[model samples]
Target: MADIKHFDPDAALETTLRLFWRQGPEATGIQDVVSATGLSRSSLYATFGGKHDLYLAALQRYVEQRSEPTFQRLAEDERGLLAIADFFSELVTARCTGPFARWGCMVANAHAATQNLTAQNADTQVRAILDRHHQQLCQALTQALTTARSLGQLAPGTTPRSTAEVLALLAYGINLRSRNGADAHALNQTMQTALNALTPSRR
Candidate 1:
């Protein structure tokens, strides 16, 4: 008999994540996982508990693997404002060209699916995490505004706080539109408009 490879739990979870990425959680079934991952039912159940549990694990994996990097990089980079723009640009590029473009953001999709479970909690744990992520972005924008001001990149009297707020709004708006299937060109144009608005020459 041929030797069989052991099931990889991480690999299984990633496969599930991609499926959920391509199709929302409610739309994805256990059979879809089985078909995509080629894992036996018993094995999946034994490894990840069940569908809901598996979905959460997959989302956590995505946060750790994908989302965190962008946040961390922007926070640490010098051209942090430009980094934020690039991040949004990357989002547009990913959704425009990646395999899962049409499915929308997993986190946003979860908002519709998991809102009730989180309704009574003292803090919406999911929203808290997302808020923290956005907060880092706002901080990065503040840093960028500072850098821009130092370089005389802004018009006189353009405060860092005001510029930061504008950038943050632009970032959030990009995310909201992207989740609604906005195109890359539309996002790029929006970003450029925001940039032009914040620059001295355009103001």
Candidate 2:
């Protein structure tokens, strides 16, 4: 017979995700996971394998639970440029305020951390997650920009794909800057400036 499990793996993974999101994988240890999840080392290992594996799982959860839904909304919203503006507004609000403030985005944090690692030292799985995330973000932004272009909301020369790439980088910058104590007001101003530049002049 298979061994019976005594704890909720989903709950434990959610708890572990928050721990990793707050302190990041480098600062967090297996002991930290054990402590945060209230699980023994053996149980954690039995369920999640090891530290690297657990971090990957947590990162995947973040992408699925936190990032994807937001992206989906942006891609589907018919308001186009307004939807994108709301997206950035909410992003700045979430990043600069609330319980998770200063944590930045888990994926953005991973990107920064992974950049410091040598190619041989970097985990391919993590790199894949980051790449997928970038693609999803760009795709969503592209969809929104295409909508904006159809509605004559974009600046005359703006191309959806190129502008989506620029906006994706801007989003990453907001995430990183917010982690370093950039305030909501400042971030909002930055976001507005970027959006304004993409808007057609009304004259």
Candidate 3:
């Protein structure tokens, strides 16, 4: 007879997600997932395939649960540049000192990691996540720039397309720096300089 599954799959998946998020795939192993999720090897393989499969599932979970909502909020926000500022401020604060401090974003971490990642198609998935991130940032920035231009806040002839690309890359920099121990104040100063450049100069 087949063994009946007693544990909660969603809860187990979340536990695994936290483990992978904190330690990353190169540093994490099947033993870590087993310890974090309290699942037997047979059960884990039966339900989630293997370590590589579980990592992929965890990454997808991070994108859906953590990443999508924030991006949606930024894209829909009507606060223009202030919205972008809030995003950077909140991003660095969370990265430097929050409940989830120093974890760096999973997608960003994956992009930056140089160690052995044995998962199949991980590079392709990372590219997909980054491409999605870029598109979402561009959408949010374009909206904000249109509003700022309408209100005469943008300098003459500033292009939203290019500016959004710069800010998107800037955000990636913030993520990487924060992961490497950058302080929140310093990160905010960097954000301010970027925002100030985006604004029209005083006469």
**All models, RMSD in angstroms:** 4.2, 1.3, 2.0
Worst 10 residues of 1 by lDDT: 114-123
> Which candidate number has the best lDDT?
2
Per-residue lDDT tens digits for candidate 3, residues 1-203, read: 98789999889989998888888888898988888888898889999998777877887888789877887787777777888888888888789887789888887787776335454576666567667766876777777777777767778778887888888888888888888888889889989998898788898
RMSD of 2: 1.3
Ranking by lDDT: 2, 3, 1
Error of 2 at 66 (Å): 0.5
**lDDT (CA) per prediction:** 0.71, 0.93, 0.81
- Which sections of candidate 3 miss by over 4 Å? 1-3, 114-120
Q: What is the lDDT of residue 125 in candidate 2?
A: 83
TM-score pick, better of 1 and 3: 3
Error of 2 at 203 (Å): 2.4
Q: In model 1, what are the clashing residue pairs, if there are any?
A: none
lDDT tens per residue, model 1, 75-147:
5666634655676688677766667665556655555565545444412655655566556666766776777
Better of 1 and 2 by lDDT: 2
